[model samples]
Target: MTVTAESALAGVQRIIATYAQNIDAGNTDVVADLFTEDGVAEIEGQDTFEGRETIRKVYGQFSPQTPQLHLVGNTVLTSEPGEEVTATSNLVFFARGEEGWGIQLVGTYEDTAVLVDGEWKFRRRVTKFL
Candidate 1:
């Protein structure tokens, strides 16, 4: 299949969306697979996780007691088609707890993604809380 710039951009967007969906649904188990074998995840104020196994384990720790939702938007991508792309997006985290539903966090995601075996996967994803 030919990869046009538009198609590559769309694929990268899908990867970002999928990550948010999986996290909000507490499906961290599959989240690691969205990344490269040696991909890195760095969440501000937390330990940096590298490699799929380590990333998986770190995400496993986020078993939220209440249902959560992640809203990701305003993605800006840089880089040529079929090459590693860097993207930045805003994040708004919501959750329902004893206090009722509310916004829990506001952040931004800075990501570097690459096409691997015909699929886009994250090479590095950084979360900065604000």
Candidate 2:
């Protein structure tokens, strides 16, 4: 069956939502599973995580004391038939510090997504701070 644009858009949205939820919950295993086996995640001016294992390790660095909330918005997506989908969106990072909840960073995420075993997975995501 061919994938429709609407369905692809929804799938990508779900992928983004799941990523944020898992990251906020500190479930690195699940977060990493959202990506392709060799997916790449690049954080501007920081380290780049390559592959699922590395992604899991990087996310594992987050602890209860350093909890974060990711807010995603203004998503723009483009699809190429049923093969791939690309998306760009605004991202706001909030954290609970000694004081209170506050904005930690504001950035943008450019993602490349593909279907893997009939599931949408992130092939690459580049995060840049603004």
Candidate 3:
């Protein structure tokens, strides 16, 4: 890959990695921070969240009793080049309990990211049940 393509991939990967880390670590604010100010998120056939605040609320449902870990598979990524990128990837949702981790939801996320201020921010994230 060319340097530019590599850089773009790095930016996208960073965004995905940070999201997983913050969500798994229960950093709610950080989770919200990963998204754009006007970002949107749709949860697998569930209702669609319209903004950062809305997404925060949806994420809030993952309480201490049910911590979540979202695993994104690279093989499912569909990213594009340039300052804008729209991609979709499969996500394996995990929940923690006394017995240990359990797979809860298996779905896909369609993400629209923009290179804003030299950084990538997700403008929209739509999920579909598989």
Candidate 4:
């Protein structure tokens, strides 16, 4: 199937939204599944995670009880019909602290998404905290 500009944006957006939901829900396994076999994730202040297994292992450190909400916005996508798509989005992370739920992290996600076997998966994602 050809990946048109519209399809690429929509598919990548879906992946972004799904990622936020899964991470907030502490379903890191599901989040890991959203990436390609050799996907890489680089988060600020953390070691870069390469491959799904490593990604899952690292993300497993996050406890479900912590309760985090990842708010993603302002996504921009650039792509060709049959090539990888590059996307960027702003992120606001709200987490439950000792006092209450509040914004704890602000960042931007730079991602490379590829269509693999008719599915859009993350090839590489970099999170830059601001």
lDDT (10s digit) by residue, model 1, range 1-130: 5666788778878999998899878788779999999999999998689999999998988967789998999887766666677888999999998888899899999999988888999999999999
Give me the candidate number with maximum lDDT: 4
Q: Give the poorly placed runs of model 1, Cα more than 4 Å off.
A: 1-3
| TM-score-superior candidate, 1 or 2 | 1
> Model 2, stretches more than 4 Å misplaced?
79-81
Candidate 4 backbone overlaps, count: 0
Model 1 poorest ten-residue lDDT run: 76-85
lDDT of each residue in 18-80, candidate 4, tens digit only: 999998898889999999999999987987899999899888887477777999999988545
Instruction: Count steric clashes of candidate 3.
Output: 0
Clashing pairs in 2: none
Q: What is the C-alpha lDDT profile of model 3 across 57-92, one tens digit per residue? A: 878876455676889876233655778777777789
lDDT of 3: 0.76
Where is model 4 poorest over a 10-residue stretch in terms of lDDT?
Answer: 75-84
Per-candidate TM equals: 0.92, 0.91, 0.82, 0.92
Candidate 4 has what TM-score?
Answer: 0.92
Q: Please say which candidate is ahead in TM-score: 1 or 3.
A: 1
Q: Which portions of model 4 miss their true places by more than 4 Å?
A: 79-81
Clashing pairs in 3: none
Error of 2 at 70 (Å): 0.7
Instruction: After the best TM-score superposition of candidate 2, give how far the Cα of residue 67 lies from its true spot, in angstroms.
Output: 3.8
Flag the better candidate by lDDT, 2 or 3: 2
RMSD of 2: 1.5
